[model samples]
Target chain A: MPRVPADSQTSAGFDSNLLAFTRELRAEGVAAGTAELLDAAAAIGHVQWSDRAAVHGALSATLAKSPEDLRIFEVVFERFFFRKAEETALQRGEEVAGKDPGGEQAQRIDLEALKQQIATALQEGGEGSLRDMARLAVAAFGQTQGGSGVVGVDVQRIRRSLGLRSEPQPDLPPEDARAEGVPRDRLREFEREVRRELERQTIERTRSLPPARPLGDLQRGLPTGQAADLAEIHKVVAQLRRKLATSGQLLKGQRQSSAIDVRRTVRASLQTGGVPVVLHQRPKRPKRPEIFVLCDVSTSVTSASIFFLAVLHALHDSFRKMRSFVFIERISEVTELFDRERDFKKISRAITSDAGVADVSGYTDYGRVWLEFLKLIESELHPRATVIVLGDARTNGRPAREDLFGQIAARAGRTFWLNPEPKLYWNYGDSVIDSYSEYCTTFECWTAAQLGDFVDALANPRHLPPSK
Target chain B: MSNTPKTAEELASRLTADGYLADTQTALVAWLAIKLGKPVLVEGPAGVGKTELAKSLSRVLDRDLIRLQCYEGLDEAKALYEWNYRKQLLRIQAESADSGWDKVQDDIFGEEFLLERPLLEAITSEEPVVLLVDEIDKTDQEFEAMLLELLSDFQVSIPELGTMTSRSHPVVLLTSNNSRELTEALKRRCLYLWIDYPEAEHELAIIRLKTPDLPAAVASRLIELVAEIRGLDLKKPPSIAESIDWARALLLLGADDIDAKVFRETMSVIVKHRSDLDTVAERVGVKLDGGDAASAS
Candidate 1:
């Protein structure tokens, strides 16, 4: 609860004060959603007007998610909502020197001057008894500030001057005979009444402040910027690459000296008097498979693409030569986008644009993209390449061009088709996944987790033999 | 009196005296897994006491911890046992003159030539071991599939050796940061728990416990302020470990109060990032001049 502005108002009786308080909560990074706000209002509505503790408890329960949320709510609520009379005095500018007489003016400045005189007297050291000091401080603060006077001294400050750190000393006699020139008992009664009223008013002002809303209720589904998630994706990928590099795999482009055929080495050693000797050996090169990736960049598959790009970036080091293309209503070759520092947004934007071969339209034309892909394959497909096509296979019920995919499958080492949509959505609408499934070595890629698994299988093909 | 306590300290103490290390909830979970005969899967933000729970549990329970750290490309051979090809080759070469191929093949692929990794070691150990599979979310699905049978039955299978069942049932604790949602099969095999940052009072108690020499006032103020910052929507919130660090920093500097000057000088104790510190400094509006007694109070 923060101090709300006096003039603020809301349709739900959430006046300027409440709005300002909620604003401060938001600024403090609490999730302060509309639902939590409505809940706070409901809780506040149920509480009795006089029971401050019940109101505070209700508001806390409505808003707080955890103990940490409660603690923060308490501090912020106190700072923002509690309106101390001392602050009221500061607003008046009466007690300090060079005071401003603007806005609201205090009625009696003489009482503040007298209180200052007594405080000065006490600071001058030992001139007055403790009773004398208490009398002077209270009379000056209470009389001047208490009545209808605008400019009155702070009684809490007077109590503080009387060596009372918190509340006034409980054991103090209420009488001040020397200063008031009255009977001790009578003076005591008057002083007690004034002290009680002052204490009551102070409590009323501070306790009337609203309770803070719980941070957890406010924080649910709060939008985290895309940059943060992207950075996290980057970090995870880098860590993955580092772990892979350390697993005794050769760094890309670093060739091994030779592959020692165990049988041949042993046979040569036996021929050379059973002693292992230098033997000429030709280097054995592991097959470097070419990979072609096609990704769907439709709005529905955007979340899936984020993970798809991360896996593609990670596998760049392992693959011999990789070509990537993304399509929605068009087919485009984005092999150059596989460079180490390519911007993801730029690639996504480029793939969805009309600058590519197939015409840009609202829905994918699988037949058009497939025909274009076939043309490129006939001209540029390497004998050792693996073709990977990723999409939901929705083409608005047009021709699926399954024959082109089948022909491409025949030329490549292996073909994989990945779909971000669930398997249940495969046969619906314009999706031709069922038709294209026959040509693919594997046709599965539903979640980001599955996408990563599929990419790893492609990059590290030693685990699985090449499909016929 | 009713038994439920409001404060974490009271709960922690009660749990501790019940023959459990109470403050470390993550470790308590791992210990409970052994008692309950269930695998524990703990998930939360990083540095919120996920992996440390496993480490602490190993110490508290007096069991050897077999740690299998998961990564993107971790496979069965890396997690379980792999055939020692070099050792097998040496054996084959040594036996070539005297032994036939059949005897040589049998000797090379024998259990003696198998190199046990973390998973295999946990399953084979005679003494009860705590197997900590750290950050399972980082690994691919295939690797996760490999752990499903092992985690559920406490057994691992090799093509040559068939299946190896646990000699002494190892208490399994798997941790993830939720980088990706785990397959339901893996989640179903374990008892799930989510560990969060401790409350302010609990953090204060932890500070006092870990750094006893610190002034009570300083620790209290540090806990209060750090608790305030955690309420903010920063990229990274300070963890409980950081609260202890901040208290120690204040004790070293001989400061008793939390003022703007001390806060600026020792901001690093609570805030690890520059941007987060800047945000905290702007939000905490009180100024201290080493003379503002009222403000300090």
Candidate 2:
């Protein structure tokens, strides 16, 4: 039998700080489960605690599962471990009245002196000193915009004054540009440190964690209307795709050709004296549902629509037919653009700029879009089509045209209205979700997780829709 | 006994001695995998030496490398173990009619009639081994699910013969190109190590170590140009392997300088895709032409 690894807290007593750090990582949307936490805690015993990078690596290998998670881990590691301690020290300085806290109270920075320090740090090429220089630069130059006390680093001002830009300036002579190469490269590192420091301070002051999503809660809903990074969204999309594809949910009501019917083949072989002469395969099922996606391309719901359309485009092959339409007031078919461009960003750009889907007002008018679709494209809807509407349902107080939507919904097999706005905000303002919910399935489509749930419900034939 | 490194720093040095310039993170992760007795899932863009890390670990630890190249339709019979059905049939036929039924059944199902695939071979080997599962993302979920039992327990179960456990603990490394997201169950059981492209300095050191004959200055220029080319929007960016190949090509040509002409002549060594050639030439060409002008002055 394989030897069981030692317990996470073997010799040293369990540190509550590590537990809190893992919680913070979870809050930031990393799926750092109990198993990973134990691994990380156990990993601490193997690495030297004094060597920060070594500890970081050990914890990262155990806790972070992907590059995206690693990015979050890097930010959280620096802030939670290093920045928190320094902040406490600064608070201690505050308690001591006039005594300086490691010279961190340099409010008005002398530009030339800071530049000299950066240049010296660059020349020495020591990462430790460069980090110290970043702290110094952020303390001296970082300002509280409009006295709100929200820490924002003034990177451009510092970089311009220090001549740290890498691009060759038209005014600067060629040799001068070449001479600034080393400093330019080092300045990028310095700027990264500044940003990290700024993030740490901002998070500290706000007393709230940044939007993080754990991957384990894909079926559960996410924070509504929050913008996630493209890569994170893509990861969630890929995971959802793998789950939906493998679970055979997408194969519902569709013909799957691979598996043979042994019983049927045996029964058919009886005609040939049980010699298995003619093998029989399972008969094909009914065709998969066609999908019609009508998305709101207004600025508020554009990201959600992009995600929705991207997911649809990815699973386009599984369905019988898939068509997409985008509208700001004027509705236009973007299925051709989705077909032509493989990248979601390009499709989003085309819908906004080149697809001629926007009106003069640039405001989302749900009634007008529905009316236009009803007039121009109602006949194209298949009887077995799944009509999905992706929007906030904020129709700018215009006529919601529930009658027209009901007509569209009655003609199709099923209709799903995904509102990017939170459920609490639904029907409070210009949102006509209450009127439309009576006619079709309505879901609060805020996060990618919710999108995955909606897709699951849409693909799984056994999953019944919510009661109207 | 296995020669696993006592510490991460020692592992780093050992890997360096094996000619794999692992950064601190890679070294620490690999060491922790060994220390914790877990598999390391190494993921990154293609050509970042994810497979090479497994090989270097095998060499450094004096373990035999047992590789399983995963592809589409990879299944239990190919990956774990397969019954030698033809041999079993022949054995059954060769047995005398007078032999008892139980004797014939046991004789055909014996170990001699078993064909050991990579997983079973690694488990059954007497010496310590390094199990490298390459391009794991290419395989589907069923294959991945089949691996979960073997990965977690280091054992495989054959219905006729029962479970076959490992004699020695083998170091396991699974490399992925991140083409698809692997199931969380597989990831949870393994230590994750993501190897992105190395930094310019690290790449320089790698070039120096891998191609000692190439002039250091020329290698630096080639790496810098390659970095520039990577910045362009290309279908396939030149990876570290391509960088080393470019360095070896330059050394073979006895080219001291990489001006626009030398770069144009040997650019195909790195840029593989035909569609990317125009874009790379248009973008990286400017850098080389500028370098040529600077050299002339």
Candidate 3:
């Protein structure tokens, strides 16, 4: 017969303890599936059984999919596999009672020795012998499998084998009869605390996230108020001025400098034999033309005004003369406001506050604004100055003074209107744009890019070269 | 150089030379659409490369681009004409007509009356025009309807006179941040392409192209790290533009390799939102350097 170690299995190659633990795990909700069992067996076969971390990893990988699942596995694995050391002491107590019948002292010595052995084994890793002693003690002392009775054993024998002193039994209950110590109220409070903490953390996390883009940088570099698309418009404005300068078409101030003005230069040249040479040089008349800009700064058309101002500013440089006015509720002169470089934010605030305007009014009143502009044009505008009105003509049910516009057109060298609103929305509101359209020499859509192109065409005289 | 079918592979190679990388078939189509005068409507998340296509097209074409940024209440005059009032008045005074009404009317509404806005200018330009209509979806439905004529005919009709048509047709390019839906009429008028975020290899190529001076090892590592971060649920995934910014930041700091220390210092370059940074910090087992200085350890 082959002798087996006290800690070894009764039958070779049979892990009876591990099989018992697996059975308990299956009884609980944990499903140690066939694959997991196979993997566990193979892992245990490869690694040293004492390495607990490796075992834990192999089992966890086989069983768990998420954090919640891992937590469940930890609880179930601990309950079924990590047996408590004090369990053997309870078994030893039952053994002493059964062998010695009514002997309490014998039971105390046996229990003390068992407790010492369990503590020693738990501290170190050589707990196989202690596990065997626990099993043997339970088998010998336990009556029937389900019966509630304590067995008896030789206390001195147990004490000498393990290492402990005699002690009387305290009022300890049986392991099965002992109630779980966790308080229901304490557990519920812990759960509530955890939920509140999680809610707070979620709120904080959400608050820390950034807002959507585009909304954050809406009008950063757009043309608005005083700061127009100057660079883009200058090229066009210069061309127009040069075209007028070279044409000698007697454009307003050009009449005084016309080569065909024989009465003036020729009369003076008679003193030089009518050669018209070396006559007292005729003074170059300043080409200071008047320009009126009627911009619609209504909430719906504010962006349109920025591009108009850009073209106006560029034209001002080319013409060296212009009077600009912005209108939403009423027309107000903003030429001085636009002379400097001001961004939309600053100019928008100033315009709203009635800054740089003779009068302050809210919202675009196209009819009233145009009437006011017509009054200024007839009374103060030089006949030589060109009158330009910029607006979308959406007057919001207000009267459109088409007759006043016609009168201004009659008095000035030319009266022109710029409508930023698309033609489709022309007749929808107080948009008397169609009525005013009759007075405008040319009406076209003026987006920022288009405004720049138009100004460049006006500025560069080469495109519209001076007449031969 | 070869007369092949110009596959996505070929386009990708060309884009690499131009300092861009064509990652997906959609991006390749977008690149081709731009080159071939087809309008591309790129719609995606905010950080994705919708608007960047226009900028890159400007660089690639080497043309003076005209951009018409669309928004609420964007109308024709702002997009197209204004009259020369001062010049018209001067003309009226110079003519000295006894019948001033007729003279003013004719003078105000003459050739001098016409103001060439962007659409008209692009149409009339002798040189090739790259007209970028940016963020078209922001404008109202009526605006979209108005664009049909301009996009189809490259001409605008002024009822006062007749249709003003283009002498030189422009390469019409329109972009939408997709604030709202655009009209079907507008969509039907042109060829469409959509741009998406780059894949791994293309993203790597983009980083290399953008930061040519960066060491190859650093660029590759940065791309890999950013790609990994994108996999996580982030508030703002690192865009191609952001990736370039991050790579540049790293190169500026003299980091030839991406490591925990370097990444911690330059987290802001790639991860814009505070929440995104926190989430990334937690997921990657790193410390949030500033503010609370909390450690994952």
**Top candidate, metric DockQ:** 2
Error of 3 at B45 (Å): 3.4
- Order of all candidates by TM-score, from best down to worst? 2, 1, 3
Preferred candidate (DockQ higher): 1 or 2? 2
Each model's lDDT comes to: 0.60, 0.76, 0.54
lDDT of 1 by residue, A1-468 (tens): 532222334324443445576667766665565544544554454444355554455445444433344556665665553443334554675353212221122334355454444434433334233234444444455544453321112332344333322112234344421232222223333333333344334433444423333443212211111444556556666666665454334433465465667666677899788776856564554455678887666544555666566556665655547777776666776666667446554544455454363454456777777777888666677667888886778777678889987888878768888776555456755677778878775545643345456646655665443544
> What is the TM-score (0 to 1) of chain A in model 3?
0.39
Q: Give the docking tier of candidate 3.
A: incorrect
TM-score of each predicted structure versus truth = 0.39, 0.64, 0.36
What is the model-wide C-alpha lDDT for candidate 2? 0.76
Better of 1 and 3 by DockQ: 1
TM-score of chain B of 3: 0.81
Deviation of model 3 at B168, angstroms: 1.5
Worst 10 residues of 2 chain A by lDDT: A218-227
Tens-digit lDDT string for candidate 3 (B143-237): 78878888866788877657888876576778775566666556545444444466666778777777789999988877767766875656577
List per-candidate RMSD values in Å.
Answer: 27.8, 12.3, 36.4
Give per-residue CA lDDT, model 2, range B1-297, as digits (tens). Answer: 548788888999999999999998899999998888889999998999999999999999999999999999998899988899999888788875678889989888889999999999998999979999999999999999989988888998899998898998889999999999999899988899999888899999999999998888998998888887876557788999999999999999999989877887788999999867766776676466535633532
TM-score on 0 to 1 scale for chain A of candidate 1:
0.45
TM-score of 1: 0.39
Best-matching candidate per TM-score: 2
